[model samples]
Target: MTRKHIDCRSFPSEINCSIAISADTDRELLEAAVQHAVAVHGHHDTPELRNQLRGAIMDGPPTEEQPAR
Candidate 1:
């Protein structure tokens, strides 16, 4: 299994936390992870959070790159 970190900034408030998951390289898995993060974490309806997750997925697994390339 692979893992990736989702960075969340803390400026106005200090609660810097990184979400680490078995790195998802596909859209479906990525979508599931994003939904889980939003529902489990307190990042619902947040564009930044969604973008960050999408970016992480795009970054791809350490052993492989996105097929779209």
Candidate 2:
């Protein structure tokens, strides 16, 4: 199966979060993202938040970036 990924660098953040997560399944990716959002980004764990995270899911592995601004 094609891997899925999510990148914090895609979004604008004051902390300049550079985390990139990849997984073999949606369930795994969502769990990791939820933990990151709550523990680091100070976001609450909720269905709405999970939905947003699910929306951000990418089709394949993440690519390298220049840097976060």
Best by lDDT: 2
Tens-place lDDT digits, model 2, residues 1-69: 999988998778789888999999999999999999999999999999999889888888988963332
TM-score of every model versus the real structure: 0.40, 0.89
lDDT of each: 0.49, 0.89
Q: Any runs in candidate 2 off by more than 4 Å, and if so which?
A: 66-69
Tens digits of per-residue lDDT for model 1, 1-67: 4444333321122343333344444556567767766666656757786676677553433333223
The 10-residue segment with the lowest total lDDT in model 2:
60-69
Steric clash pairs (candidate 2): none
- Of candidate 1, the 10-residue stretch with the lowest lDDT total is 5-14
- In TM-score terms, candidate 2 sits at 0.89
Query: What is every candidate's alpha-carbon RMSD to the true fold?
Result: 7.7, 2.4
